[model samples]
Target: MKTSIIIADDHPLILKGLNDFLLEKKYNVLASAVNGKEAFELIETHNPEIAILDIQMPFLTGLDIAKKCKELNWKTKIILITFEKDENIYNEAKNLGVYGYVLKEFALAEIEHCIDSVIKAMPYFSPELLSYLEVEETPKKLELLTPTELDILKLIAQNKTAKEIGELMFISNRTVEKHKSHIIKKLDLAPIQNSLLIWVKENQKHLE
Candidate 1:
């Protein structure tokens, strides 16, 4: 059977372009959505094998829909198309069990590969996005953080509060704060006021 898919994007031209492209490729284009709400509704109704969602949309973001899908235990695999190359966003998508991450600029070239990988139950991230993240400084700094510290840093980058991180890691809030302090000192960001969060935001691309 042909792979059934639903495509969602806020832009009319892009949505039409993607729908046309997928139809030409002979995939079963079950539906197209103009926003995340519509996208989720179509997914719930059609139960398509794959969902291609733009990261930014009205009412609900693509990540929001992906999280909802996970919560509902939907089988529809999510492929997030976005202009964002932020590592923190990518990390969140991965954590939410997104099957594919395709940059909008590379969508035409990479979407087929992404779909194929997802069909095989594998994860796919755009090569262009990966290439942009291949910075030396980030890795060098990341090497200073221990595995536990790195985990906490990722949570911090996600904007998780100390209590949230503690609950997620099965630790106390005080321990989470201690880890944050160590992370700040190790990254040499303690000199600046409120630098840990700032540093995480600035260096997220490298940290990932």
Candidate 2:
């Protein structure tokens, strides 16, 4: 039998596009909703095997509906679609036992695979989202650095040479190099040539 699915998004175009795509794939789309309340209502009525929902919606968000489904002990699996790459939201979705998390930018390309994973009772999260989360977390890792390391990192970000940094800090070039090594170790950066300078250039904003 074809899989039964419910899809919801506040944006009409997104709703239409997703609904059309799913229909084209020959899945039985039980309903499409423009808001979270309507989507949850449809879910309750149709009892579909899967629900693909937008994270932001009027009345209730996708996470809200997922929470409700968990509370009701429903068998329906949820696949959330959103533009947000927020760590807190992602963690909350995991805590709610959400089956899939997809980014809107890649939704059309990824939804089919996401649904397949859901059918197999496996969790799926967008690779782009995961990469974004990793980049976002890199800043937080700066907390592992000491004040001296942070100052050195800031100087490195400013394109300072080891001799220049040493002169500015009243330290020797060797001490500056040692500090750079310590900074690299604390940040868990690769030991490749100019790797520290490359990292500083890429993450300069975090130094501020």
Candidate 3:
């Protein structure tokens, strides 16, 4: 039997596009909704195997609907589409048991694959989103460095030597080296030639 699906989005273009694509793929598109409330009603009435929802909408958000479905113990699997790459929202979706998360920029390209994974009872998150989360972790890891270590790291990013940094900060070369070592351990950076320098260079933006 063809899979039953309902797609919802506040944007007419997205709603129509996704509905049309799924129909063309020969899936049974039961309905399309323009808001979370209407989308929830469709799910309650039709109980489709899949619900493709925009993460942000009027009345209630996609995460809100997902929470409702979980509360009702419904079998409808949710695939959230959004432009947000926020860590908190992503974590909430995972906690709500959302089956798929596709960035709006890549929705049309990734929807088919996301649907397939959900049907197989597997969760799918955008690969781009994962990469973004990995990059985001660098800023958090940097928080482990003390003020002195952070100052030295920033200087290193600017291509300053330990001696130069010590002069600027009114510290001894030995003290600067000690701070560098502490930063390396705190950040869990690999022990290798200029690893600290490499890390500082790579994460220069976060220093700003």
Candidate 4:
């Protein structure tokens, strides 16, 4: 059976290039898409053996598509094709157990090998792509924030106390203290929550 493929990219030229490349290699071009929502529709119809996905597209991003693919338990192999080289994005892709990554610049050069490698259940990362993934462990201290802090800051304008806030947020007094410490460090404010709340409300429009 012929290997069926799909390409998802916003650019018409890029999409055409991928279609032409796959067609020249005698692969069945099942579908092509300009965005994530359209890609999802195509996947439902074609269920291609492989999908070449661009990270940044209109409506929804490729990461959203990847997440949806996982949720649906689809076994289709995905070859993420993008210009982005962010470590966080690459780590997310890896965690999703994607098959391959082909940089747009190198796709033509490495296309055939990448397809074959993925079919054999081996992961393939483009030489250009490998340098972007420098995933480091997030420090426990940095990530460690008490529930009180979260609740207080997230809904700081509610004007609740450590006791009242904890009850509302479903935490305890000790947790509240930890939250206060974390909040102090985070906002560099006085020990009181009201002033901090007012300050945050005044200056945190972007956050809201």
Candidate 3 residue-wise lDDT, 134-199, digit = tens: 633358888787887888888887768788999999999999988888888988865533456545
Clashing pairs in 3: none
List pairs with backbone clashes in candidate 4: none
Q: What would the per-residue lDDT of candidate 4 be over residues 15-118, giving only the tens digit for each residue?
A: 99888988999888888999988997888788888888898999878777877887788877788888877778876776666677778888888988889876
Whole-model Cα lDDT of every candidate shown, in order: 0.84, 0.86, 0.85, 0.71
In model 4, where is the ten-residue run with the lowest total lDDT? 134-143
Q: Which segments of candidate 2 are over 4 A away from where they belong?
A: 135-208
Q: Candidate 2's residue-wise lDDT over 128-173, tens digit each?
A: 9877876333687799888888998898767677888899999999
User: Candidate 3, which segments miss by more than 4 Å at Cα?
Assistant: 135-208
- Model 1 agreement with the true structure over 1-208: per-residue lDDT tens digits: 5799999999999999999999999999999999989999999999999999999999889999999998898999999999999988976776677888899998999999889977866567777776686522355778888999999988877767788899999999999989888877777653433356545655677657
- Model 1 CA deviation exceeding 4 Å by range: 135-208
By lDDT, who's the top model here?
A: 2
What is the TM-score of each predicted model, taking all chains together? 0.65, 0.65, 0.65, 0.62
Error of 4 at 170 (Å): 55
